[model samples]
Target: AQSVAQPEDQVNVAEGNPLTVKCTYSVSGNPYLFWYVQYPNRGLQFLLKYITGDNLVKGSYGFEAEFNKSQTSFHLKKPSALVSDSALYFCAVRDTKTGFQKLVFGTGTRLLVSP
Candidate 1:
């Protein structure tokens, strides 16, 4: 089974300040990790992914995440946050052991950026 955990329910940040949303996962095989963001009443949009290569992966809207194998964590980061950056973020993991791609998503973390 594959699962993702987003420990924080909400994160508040000021505009121009850096922000981070944390996520951790568990999987049977090599994990395919992803982060997605959703605005109010909208569907999730892909942010970034960690399939292979560098530990740090950059994504859309100036978002990036660092994949830590030892800790089984993928924490999303933004160098500078904007008011528009406020949204609900989700962390997901694919279960390779099933031979089928089954994405398990975290509960989601709401980011609030104030001006």
Candidate 2:
């Protein structure tokens, strides 16, 4: 079985400051980690992914995440936060044992970026 954990329920950051949303996972095999954002009443939007390659992966809207195999973590980061970035973020891991058929998502983290 595969699972994800997002310890914080919410993250607050001032506009223009840096931001990070942490995520940890457990899986049977090499994990396929991903980050997604959801605005109010909208579907999940893909942020970034760590399938294979560099430990550091960049994605939409200036967001990035570092995949740490030993730590089993894929933490999302942005150099400069924006008010528009305020949204619900989720960390997900593909159930590799299922051959990428399923994704187990974390209990979302709400990012509150204030101006």
Candidate 3:
């Protein structure tokens, strides 16, 4: 079985400061990882993904993630965080070994960027 873990329940940061949300994953075979952000009363928005290729993957809203194979981690990062970036973030893993590409998601990590 595959699983994702967001160790921190919440990450507090001041506006304009750099921020990071941690995520680690477990899988039987090669892992397909993804990050999603959700705003109040809104669906999850795609942030970034790591299927294969470069160790560092960039995504929307000045966000990027480094895929660390050794640590089995894909932590989301931003040089500067905005108040608008405050939201609930999720880390997911797609189990390609199964017929259906079901995504296993972590509990969630809430980001609070204060002005």
Candidate 4:
């Protein structure tokens, strides 16, 4: 009973502006959260993860995320978006009871950037 949903199929962004991809989750117990990015024909790259402490967690490529407990959500954010940032974003959740290693990925949210 652990899963994630990325509501937006894709997001179009400019070269420089704030960007966000939304995610929501359902789990039996406390969840381990993660964010990953995928390039064309590639697997996912770890962006960030939330195991415990600090609602705000920072990660690779100037990306960060806020873990909201009450809302049962983790949303990824970036102050300045880049053309290079154009890729697919995935939000995931791992069940704490299940060793927190099995990641359930979202359908994936494509991020398109234009120069």
Candidate 5:
């Protein structure tokens, strides 16, 4: 089965420091990977995706990810984090065979960025 695993339940970091939220996945054949962030009660905001291309893919809010096929990982990264960047992050994988774009998301990672 296609699945995404976010090992960390929460990540705390000082403001302006680099940040990372780990993610690992398993899928049959090829798959689409995505990252999204949610704030409070609001819906998830799309961050990035790795369809197929170079190992490194960039996204909004100065975030990026490196798709490592051998390791079956796609960890999110940011050079300089901000207090405002704090939120709940979810790593997901596209279940294409389902014939729907339904995304299987991780439990979630709470990003506690402190000033």
Candidate 6:
């Protein structure tokens, strides 16, 4: 079975400082990894994805992720974070080996950015 793990339950950062949300995945085959952010009273928004090819993937709102096949990790990063960036982040994965393209999501990590 495919699974995603987000070790940290919450990440706290000061505004304008760099932030990272760690994610590691396990799958039978090549994995399709994704990151999503959910704001208060809002649905999950697509942040980035790593389907194939590049090791580094960029996404919305100055967010980027590095896909490390060796480590089986895809950690989300930002040069500088804003207070508005505070939200719940999730890591998900889909196993390419299976015909069913169901995504397995992590528990979720809450990010808090303070001024």
lDDT for residue 105 in candidate 4, whole number 0-100: 90
What would the per-residue lDDT of candidate 2 be over residues 16-59, giving only the tens digit for each residue? 99999999999887888999999999999999999999999999
Q: Candidate 2: lDDT over CA atoms?
A: 0.95
Clashes of each: 0, 0, 0, 0, 0, 0
RMSD of 6: 1.0
The parts of candidate 1 lying over 4 Å away from their true place are none
TM-score of 1: 0.97
Report the lDDT tens digits of candidate 1 across residue range 45-80: 999999999999999999999999999999999999
As for lDDT, the candidate ahead, 1 or 4, is 1
Q: Evaluate residue 10 in candidate 5 and report its C-alpha lDDT on the 0 to 100 scale.
A: 95
| Candidate 1 weakest ten by summed lDDT | 94-103
Candidate 3 regions with alpha-carbon error over 4 angstroms:
none
Tens digits of per-residue lDDT for model 3 on 1-115? 8999999999999999999999999988888999999999999999999999999999999999999999999999999999999999999999766658799999999999999
The C-alpha RMSD of each candidate to the native structure, in angstroms, is 0.8, 0.8, 0.8, 1.3, 0.8, 1.0
lDDT of each: 0.96, 0.95, 0.95, 0.90, 0.94, 0.95
- Which has the better TM-score: candidate 1, or candidate 6? 1
Model 1, residue 25: C-alpha shift (Å) = 0.9
Number of clashes found in candidate 2: 0
TM-score of every model? 0.97, 0.97, 0.97, 0.93, 0.96, 0.96
lDDT of 6 by residue, 1-115 (tens): 8899999999999999999999999988788999999999999999999999999999999999999999999999999999999999999998665678778899999999999
Check candidate 3 and list the clashing pairs: none
> Could you give candidate 5's per-residue lDDT for residues 1-115 as a string of tens digits?
7899999999999998999999999999896999999999999999999999888999999999989999999999999999999999999999977769999999899999999
Worst 10 residues of 6 by lDDT: 94-103
